[model samples]
Target: MACRDDDYRFLPIVDAISAINQNVNLVGVVLETSIPRQFKGTDCFCTVKIIDESYSSPGLLVNCFGENMEKLPSVHSAGDIILFSRVMIKSHCGDVNAVFNKKISSFAIFEGKHGTQFLPYQASANFHPRDEDNKFLDCLRKWLLNRNPDESISLFGLNEYLPLEDIRVGEHLTLICKVLHICKVQENKWMAFVWDGTDAPRANMRAKKENEIENLPPLQLEPTPLPRDVLLKFPTIGTILRVVMEDDNQGLQLLNCDRWVKLVNVKCEKYAGLWRCMLMPSSKLQYLSDTEKLISESQRNYEKRLTLKRRREPFSVHLPPPSSMMTETSYTEMPFVTLMDVITHPKVTGKFKCAVRVIAIRPFQSEDFCSPQGIYRITLTLEDATARIHAFLFAEDSEYFFDGYPSDRTLKRTRNALLGVMIPSGRSNEEQQCAQRNPPWVQLCLKSYYTDKNDKWGTRKYRIFATKVVD
Candidate 1:
């Protein structure tokens, strides 16, 4: 087990610190390893820090650059002991580091009871002095076996904020970002654009399809119809959110696991006189001070944008203006039926006007029978003091009211657009239009009918379809 005097000696970390630019060998336990990042062309590099308890100095940072990075994962891990040979001692800006020489250096990893195994490297055979290398490896293995696993040198528990550039595919990370835009793509899929206060490109964070509800973070602020209600109502440009994220092939995404993300609520007392003061309504921003007024203004702007965007396209048939067809009339002129009247008399089949509050609007796919080509429908949940009922809007009517249709040309885009309108903003264009023309409540002029057969609810229900949004 004795080594010859000519054999290369492994230096202590303290000795390696003083031997800048000199080739040295050292055995240390891997403490931390960074994710591999691409440099020029296809070349990748990773940084690793290792600690040696036998030395009096601190852990040494190892820069594993070039093609040798391919073997890094297999060579060592957080708890493994590695023997680095012919590594150049490097120093810059008063910080010392060990640079692995990919062309002439080699490394051996001693993990668990696997003894010693040298990884293939350039000129690896000529660099190893067999007897001396084996003796050093054996001694290091004994020292590792005698030590407790918990007592091993590690650099965990140091929570540091990682920049967007440092994020890599398949790495779990936590980030604080601002919500830029939100769109609902499907019944369960919600996509959001976020910026992490960096110059990096905006990232897309999507709600995971599976375990969707269970994984959502608890709202730190008061409960509202939508998450980040205030931000969604007003400008979504600067709403801060703290989220736990993971990178996939698509890019950085919200972590699908439960309780991994949260919306950090700003406590006014703790953040007094800070930048968050502008975000709070009780403070100085004049326009944002009134919640009702801000929501009303935001709703108007949203409708205007949606209307202008949809109106630019050519339609198969010319549409009439809202004022021309659905003129406001007194209650006696229309004989408006209350929602309770229709619910109580399920067989009611006649034109009746009802003033009701819009609760929810969703894209409807009818299962009763086949719908015509290029025809789309929407079901609006309307509530009055008496009862709640679903009113269907079909084809051209749906398009006129909500700017949505099921035609092949605009099916997908229209569906996504309608969903986005319903989700965060809390009001559809039809609802807003109705509210504007009629204060306190909106009236729907429609015909109601009931099928002879009973449904799952065990009763033949009355169905209403709006022909116009009457005042």
Candidate 2:
């Protein structure tokens, strides 16, 4: 049968193992095959042992039953690469297995030179080349080449690392370790304490400054101390890392000019998928797993707790007093401009801080706006005491004002507000009252810009992009 477009794309066997109960696609070389067998009063089934280069040791067992079994080519044998789609992943004991769905799953055997041609058993099935698939195959080929005994210091050889305790001073070594803690030691400099699985002291490594880091190759996928937001997303503590370092006077440090540090955990297919979802708008996060949803909820609650704790704590008397220069810095730097100033001075385009009342909020029509897919936009009629103007918030920015709540109800309310209609349900009395207030107030940090609307007036319109929610 034809696989649905929603069927999972091909993943490494390791990822298929992690994503149990979900549909998966896999491409593997068949190591062994079994003849079709029938159980009493049940459908005939066949089994095949296949291996993808991503995993070593025991290969994956694919069980094809019913129509899938009937559709298997008569000459299918070992050494053949097959692409399986829409197969359900199930855990049997401690091992993962792929079970074919009778109606929606299909397989294609790659049959030509360079493995370009895929012959599908069923006409309804669609098979096409994917960039990720090609990249995976290329990686697999490199791995296979490295596995040959004659190849010395192969590309995949870095997986083998010497024990941290075994290294002597002045000796260059590769080691797999986990980051235990990271702290900022100086401006643009950070220290990381790492521990490999050995009876050795934790290695302290310092990050190179921008000037030194600039000398490294651009294509190197090495792990470094990331920005605060990016660092929070990574499984830093307890996640494995591969690094090539030298035993120096100050214990182990990264080799001065090479791209040797690699964060291994994020390379897992499941984590890679989660990272992609994070980059998307809040609307797109719905497809994430229940585990991810729980993690996000927990993180939000923790942040709320921290905020409340900070609010309750009084300022310490021992803290140093602010300098006169520091006190005046805020007034001198980036002063908030009035809405009238923004409208009159079209050339003055930059970030502005302002407090305004939301007179009306108009949600843009999804079909009319040529926005990036999966993103939604809202227009706010914001007015200060002097003048009123429109500010636009898209996707992530809109979600922030809505208190990180992304739902059809929120969209409906914005749409209704644009038409001056009331939905009048689902919300509590307090919320309804708040919505009916004379004017809703909001504080904003906006990016000001001017655009020619090409209207009957034949003049440019001033608009602001809502970059942040201050209140």
Model 1, residue pairs in steric clash = none
Give the TM-score of each candidate.
0.36, 0.28
- Model 2 RMSD in Å is 26.4
Which lDDT tens digits does candidate 1 get at residues 1-471? 111235577877777778888788887765555444444575555555666656523578887665634444333224456677778888999999988866766666555224456432223333464556566656656765676534432222213333332333332333333344444433433334433322221122221222112232222211222333323332211223322111211111222211111121211111100111011111100001112222344345435533452221111122233234332323335545555454444344656666554443453222211255655545655644333466676666554543443344344333333222223357765553333111123556655655644442233333344443332
lDDT (Cα, tens digit) per residue for candidate 2, span 1-471: 222366545778877777778777887755444434442355655565667767554678787776433454222323346677777888988878888765776666643113443343232244455555555455544554455533312222333444333433232233433344444433433334443322221121112122112332111123432343433333211212322211111112221111122122211111200101001010000011112222345345435533542221112222122221111112223444445444444243556654444444443332322255655465666654334466776666555545454466555454333323342579775554344323323345566654544441223243434433222
Stretches of model 1 off by over 4 angstroms after superposition: 1-7, 40-43, 55-58, 68-73, 112-129, 153-471
Q: Report the Cα RMSD per candidate.
A: 20.2, 26.4
lDDT of 2 at 296: 44
Cα RMSD for candidate 1?
20.2
Top-scoring candidate (TM-score): 1
Off by over 4 Å in 2: 1-8, 40-42, 73-75, 111-471
